[model samples]
Target: MFCTCLCLVLAVSGGVATTTAPSLADKHNALGFRVFAHLASADRNLVFSPHGLSAVLSMAQLGAAGTTDEAMKRVMGFSLRERGASRQHRRMRRQLRAEEALRTAGAVAVERTMSVEKAYRRALSRAFGSHPLQVDFGRPERAAEVLNAWVADHTAGAVPELLAPGSLSDETRLVLLDALHFRGLWKVPFDPRLTHRGLFRGANGSATPVAMMTLTGRFNYGEFSTAGGEDYDVVELPYRGDTLSMFLASPFEADTPLSALAADLSGRGTPEWTSRLGSVRRQLSVPRFAVDSELRLKTALTDAGLANIFNVATADFSRIAAHERLCVSDVLQTVKFEVDERGTEGAAATAAITYSRMAVEELTLDGPFLFFVQHKPTGAILFMGQFNHPT
Candidate 1:
C-alpha cells in the first residue's frame, strides 16, 4: 500500500521521465567532485560535500529537467576545478567515461522540455519516492504562486512565501521546482526571544549586528592550525539520519590568509579529523538573502569535461535522440536560497544565487567570506559563488 501510494505521488507530482537506466551512482561521484572544489576556492572560501551537491542538483533538476546529465557534470566539475583539484589528474580522468557508454539502447529522445513544476515533481519523487508532496508546473506566472505555496506548506510557514512571480523566464522552455520542508527538534534549540543583534564583520571591514542561532551538542570536528600560517576550525553538523552532515569552517582570526589556507588543503588530513567528535556550544548566525540567476548550461558543460555531449560533430545523446544531428539548444538554470535556525527551507528555484555569510573579520568586514554546498551520496558542489562587497 505504501509503495502504491508513493508511486502515485511520484507519477503525479514528480515529473521524472522514465529511462532505461537503473540509478546514477557513477555520475554522483563525478558531480560530487565538482561541488567540493567550487565552494572551497580561496576567494569564496566555502566548504561543501556530496550531500550539498545532491540537494542543489535535485533542486535544479526539479525546475529544469531535459538532458540533466551534461549540465550536472559541468556544475559539479566547475565546482571541483575551483577548489584546487587538478583538471587532468588520473582520479579526475576516471570520471570522464566515454559518451557512448552513457546512452541507453533503443532510447527515443523526446523534444518536450519538462517544465520547472514537472522537474520539481520529478525531484520530489526521487527524494520522497512515493510520499505525497504538492507540485505543479504550468504558465510562467503561475510558477511563483505554486512555489510559494509549496514552500509555505513544507517549511510550516518558516518561509511564508517563495516566488514573487515572473521569477522565471516567461519564454522559458522548462522549469524545475523543489519544495523541501524539514522540522527537527534541535539537539539544543535556541530560545527565539533570546536572539540578540551581534556583530558580523565582512570583507570590507564593516560590521553589522545580526541574530545568531545558538545550540550545543556532541559533534564531529577537525581543529587545525595550518603550516601555511593559518588557523581554522572545521565543524561537522550531522543531520538526523546520519546519512548527511554539514561541514562548516571558520578561520580562528579574521585576517588569517585564506588563499594560503586553501593552498595547503589536502584531503589526506580530513579522515584523521573524523575522530574528533565532542560536545561544545555552537553560535550560528546565517544571513537571509534572495537571488536569481540564469545561465547557459550547455556552454558551461562544454567548458567542464563533457564537450563531447554538446559537440554536434561528436555528440552522443543517441540513447534518447533519433539522429546525431540534434544538440542541446539551450540549458537554463535558476536557483534560490534562504537560511535560518529552522534548518534551510528554500530551494534553488531558478539558476542563480544571492548569498550572505558571516564576514572574514571577527570585528570588522575587511576580509572575505567563503562557503560551499555539497552532496552526501558523492561529495560535489552544485553551485559556487562569492562576493567582495562590504555592504
Candidate 2:
C-alpha cells in the first residue's frame, strides 16, 4: 500500500571534513563524473546530484542479488557487499549529519503485498537515517501525494513536486526518489551592484545577455591541459562553509567545445585539478544562474551497463522483499541549485582581506563551462553539470 521515497539534501555552509578516506572519495568522484558525462550536453545548462542518486541506488543495492548486484557494483565503483562497506557508509552519513549545514532525510514506503526486511530497514536507518512507512500504491494518486509531501518537507520546500500525477500506478512495484537542494553562498560575497548584463558567448557561437557577477579576491585557482593537449582554467569558489566548494572549468580557446573539457573531467576526475590548485588573486566573473533538473535514471543507468536490475525476470531483490516479483519500476532524481552574490551568514563579517599589488588574472565564464560541487576533504563530488545557457 506504500510507495518508497529516498530523499537526500546536501547544503554546504563553512565546514570541511577531516576524516574522509581518499580512496573511497576518489571512487565516488569518478562515478559522479561518469554519470555527468552520460548526461552531458554542449548547448544546454545541466545539473544533477550524483551523491543523491548514488545514495538511493546504494540503498537499493542492499537488497540485490547475483548479476544484478555485480552490475551495480561495476558502474557505481563500490560494492555494498564488500567488507565494512556498510559500516563505512554509516560513518560517512554520521559525519554528514553532524554538519549543521548539511540536511539529509530518507524514507521507505512499503506496499501490503511486499514484506520489508528487518536487516534492510536497519541498514537504511543506520546509513541514511531512513524510516519505513506504509502507503497504498493501489491508489496511485494518493501515493504520489504522500511521497511528494515527504520530499517537500525534507527539502524545506526546495523540491515541491517530485512525482507528477500518474507517475505511480497499481502496476508500479517500486519507486526510488532522491532530491538534493543546495544554495551555497560564496566565501566572499559578490557585490550586487557590480552584477550587470554581459554578453554570454553561446556554444553555437552566438552571444546572449546575462547577469554576470564580478569580484576580485584570492581563490583556489589552476590551469591544466586536457588529454587532447588543450589548455583550460579551473577556479574553486568555496561556500560559506569551507567544507564544500564549487570548481568551475572552461577551455581557453573560444572555439574549443565544452565536450572536450567534459571528457577530460570524466577521464581524470577532480584530483587532477585539486592537486594543481593554488591560492591566487584573480578577477572572477561568473553568471548568476539557477538550474533545476529532473532525470529518470533508468536509461542512463542502462547505458552505463546497469541493465540487469531493471529486468523483472532477471532482477533479484530478495533481500528487501521476497514476496513479490519486484523490479525497480522507476528511479528518479531531482535537483535544485542556485548561485548568487550572497553566501552563508556572517561571511561578510569574516571575509578576509586580500591586498595584492600585482595585476590580477581574470577568469570569466562568459561561455559554456563545466562545474562540480565537491566535498573538500573527502573529494566526493556531490553535484556535477555544465552551464551552457542559464535557465
lDDT of each: 0.35, 0.66
Please give the lDDT score at residue 213 for candidate 2.
94
List ranges where model 1 is wrong by over 4 Å.
1-109, 112-185, 216-218, 225-229, 238-244, 256-277, 280-303, 329-332, 350-391
In terms of TM-score, how similar is model 2 to the real structure?
0.86
Per-candidate clashes come to 60, 15
lDDT by residue (tens digit), candidate 1, 1-391: 0000000001111111223331243344445434334333333323222322333343333222235445544554332222222222223223311211111010011113422233334334444232222233335456546545554554345444434454443323322233332222223434566555656655445575556554444444455666665776655544444433445555667666454434333332222333454444444443332223333344444455545433334433232222213233333333333334544322332222210022222211123433333223333233333322223
Cα lDDT of model 1 overall? 0.35
Among all candidates shown, the one with the greatest TM-score: 2
User: Residues 1-391, candidate 2, lDDT per residue (tens digit)?
Assistant: 0011244211111111225454665776777677677777767777766676677777777777778778888888887657877777767665655555666555666654556778877766766566767777778789778877877676666555766776666654444444333446677889999998999887877788999999998988877787788878888888777988888888888777777887877776567658778898888999987666666666777788877766666667667766555565445665556677885211000000000012248778898888777777666677777877755
